[model samples]
Every structure is written in structure tokens, then in C-alpha cells.
Target: MSKSNFIKVIVAGFLITSIVGCGTKNFKKTPLDNYIVENSNEKQFSVILEDMDVDGTFFKTYSHKYRVIKHKEDDTPYEQISDWIEVDKKFFAKHEDNLGMVILEKKGQGKISKVASPPGYGYVGDSRYGEWRTHNGSTFWGFYGRYMFMNQMFGMINRPIYRNDYDTYRGGGYYGSRNYYGPKKGGSSRYGTNSQQTRKEKPNFFRRRASKSGWSSSRSRSGSRSRSTGFGK
Candidate 1:
């Protein structure tokens, strides 16, 4: 072959090799990239347990789902700037940590309010307690109760409070209206009527046992129901 032809061939081969290498590099995926693709529709926020002062405690590391109320673009990929509310107003946070650069902000827009303890049931001073079902169909009591206690102890009253009148469903066969103290009076409570319809139409994520991480399980109260004449009929 002529010298000129040999030089052209070498240059052509190098260009092809470079093009293939760039394509392969662009197609490579990282763990974070895979996670974001898998959970594209999900809006997850992570917080360092140590920063919350509950790192070494039983509530060290946990994951809870929250409905994104509002957010804005920043240096990080996505930051929950405005306050966000949990289902039933059970928990709330003013802001969330940067979920790294892989996550994208959810499409829906809304506002979240802080949860408040039911009236007359002070976290630091009162003895009365209650339980409520979260949006994920998991029953959360002590975890959030402890969170409230810790916040109050440190004078972080701006955190959130639980509302006694907030609508929630009870597990098992029985369903009814739950007040600050317990089930409300009168046979036909709003919750009971609503729950009966909900149970038939909606299926929930129920766990048979507590998680190994020390999170309480709803199964503990699986048999705590007492038959009532009002809602069942």
C-alpha cells in the first residue's frame, strides 16, 4: 500500500475507536442512576440520624414516606425547601437534606403543614397517648411520639403537632371515629362509616411482625378490637 493510504487508514481507525469509547462511557450507569430510574415517581428524603440527636438511640436510622409539599432548585439536585406534611398530618419537617444529585423533584405541587399533638395531650406534660395509621398503611406511634418528646425537650416547638380530629383508619375488622382520648361517642362515627367503605375498596400494606430494626409492628394490636354495633351494620 502507498504511504499516503497507510496514514489515512491509521487516522480513520483512531477516529472510530474514539467514537466507540465515548458512546460506551455515556451508556455506563452508576448505582444512583439506577435507583433514580427505578424510583422515578417516588420522592424520597433522607436525614442524618446523628444530626437529629437520635443517632445512637433506637430511632437511629429509619425511612418514612412524605408527600412533597413544595420544593425549589438549588446547588443540590433536589432540596425540599418549603415545609412538607406527612399523611394525616402525623409528622412534618421544614426542610430536608440534599438527596444527592441523582434524584429529581416530583412533578406535583402542594403545601405541607406541621403535625400537632391532639388537644390537651401535651408531649412533655401529659400522660395520654394515642395511635394513628400512616399513609403507607403502617401504624406509627412510639417512633413519632419519641420524636415529639425530644423536640419539646429541646424547645423545638416549631416542629409539628398531631391533630386529634385528623381522619385515620384502624386495622382489624372494626373501624370507627377516634378522638383525642379514644373512640368518639355515638354509634355512627364518621371514621367507622368511612373505614368500612375504605377497607372494602382499598388494600393496605400490613406486616405480620415488627421490623428487625426495632420499629414497632402493627401486628401487636392485631387482635385489640372489640365488636361494636354502630359501623359494622
Candidate 2:
């Protein structure tokens, strides 16, 4: 073939290869994708995953718990507590309101704690400004984020909790607790004093069991219950 004709043929082959490559490219979903799919049924709920280093932000992984406060017209102020899940260097969350109107604040202290109230004694208020009462007439500060609320609602679903001797099982699934993805290296757990670890070391067996027990059907039932409960207590 002539040189010019050969050049044209080569160009055509290159174009075809490029097109095929682009068409067959696979897109890998991140952990954020899984989180969204898990909580997709939540109405008016959204997610924002960002790197803590962006713009000198302080929303670092395990360093802060995000408070999402929703303000509605002629309605009671709604608030939710969000704990960021770190995948690599980015933080992931499932928020309950409009990202713009919501007030995003960090809870005091880098860690989360539990405050139990005495029997017959109600209203355990924290020093924080956002005060709310549970159905049991117990007052507590901070809103329970989507994951946190679900973790509590479903009898401590499948999360890990830290204790005196070592880590133990809890009613709630992993959310803002120290036992979600195991310990991390070079960083302290917000919930406990455990050193760095990985998810493989502490697998979320609850999730595996749920899947084996037909999680799809159970999830549907659980979603209905969650909607009815309305995040109270």
C-alpha cells in the first residue's frame, strides 16, 4: 500500500481502539456508593463525602462527629448526629436534610459517649445547646444521624463497641462507634482507646449473617419499622 494509505489505515485502527476502550471501561464503586445504597430509602436524606484536608477543613476522619440540624417552616427543629466513615482519606456520611440549609457543626470532644439516666429521674441534659428528650422522658443532647438512629432502632444492629477488657458486640451496627471498621493505624478511635486496626481483623459478622438470612426481605420490614418509629428515642 502507498504510504498515505497506510497512515490512514493506522489512524482508523487507533480510533476504533479508542472507542472500544472507552466503551468497555469499568467504573469501580467506592464505599460511599455502598453507604448510599444501604440508606437509599431514607426520604429527604442525602450524603456528602469529602476529604478533611480540603480548604483547611477540620472534618477529619474519627476526629469529629458532624451535627446536621434541619430547620423547617412552622415545624420543630430537626437534628441528626453524623459520624464520618473514613475510606482512605475521605469522610463519608448520610445526612437527613438539605445540605445548604443544614447547620453543620462538630460535637465537642473528638469522641462519642453514652449517658445513662436514673430510673424515675428524667431529663438528662448535656451542656450543649441542642437539647432533646427521648420517649422514655430522658433528655439527651445531639441528634442521632441516620445510621446512628438505625443502629439504635434495630437493637444495636451490627456494630462494634469498646469495653474494659476488649471490644464486644453491641445492639447497634457500625456508625459513629469505635467498632465499625476496626482500629486504624496512627490514629485513635473516637469511641475507645483501641489502637489502629483494619476491617479484615474485625469483620462485620452481623452483616454477613444478615445477608445469609435474607437481608432483602428483612430490610424491607426494618425500613417500615424505622419510618413508624420516627427517630424518637
The models' CA-based lDDT, in order, is 0.27, 0.29
Q: Give the TM-score of candidate 1.
A: 0.19
Query: Candidate 2 residues 1-233, lDDT tens each?
Result: 99999999999999999999898684444443443454444323322211111111232222122333333454223445544333222121222111111112212232221121111011113222223434455333332452244222211223222231121222333224322322344665422212222122224522443344332222122211000111111
Off by over 4 Å in 2: 1-26, 48-77, 88-233
Per-candidate Cα RMSD to the true structure, in Å, reads 21.5, 17.6
The model with the greatest lDDT is 2
Off by over 4 Å in 1: 1-10, 19-28, 40-104, 108-233
Which tens-of-lDDT digit does each residue in 1-233 have in candidate 1?
99999999999999999999998974534222333455455442221111110011322222222221121243112222222211111111111221111122222221111211121122222233334435544433322453444343322343122333323322321122222222344542222112232123223311211123322322121211111111010
TM-scores for all candidates: the values are: 0.19, 0.20
Residue-level error in angstroms, candidate 2, position 140: 31
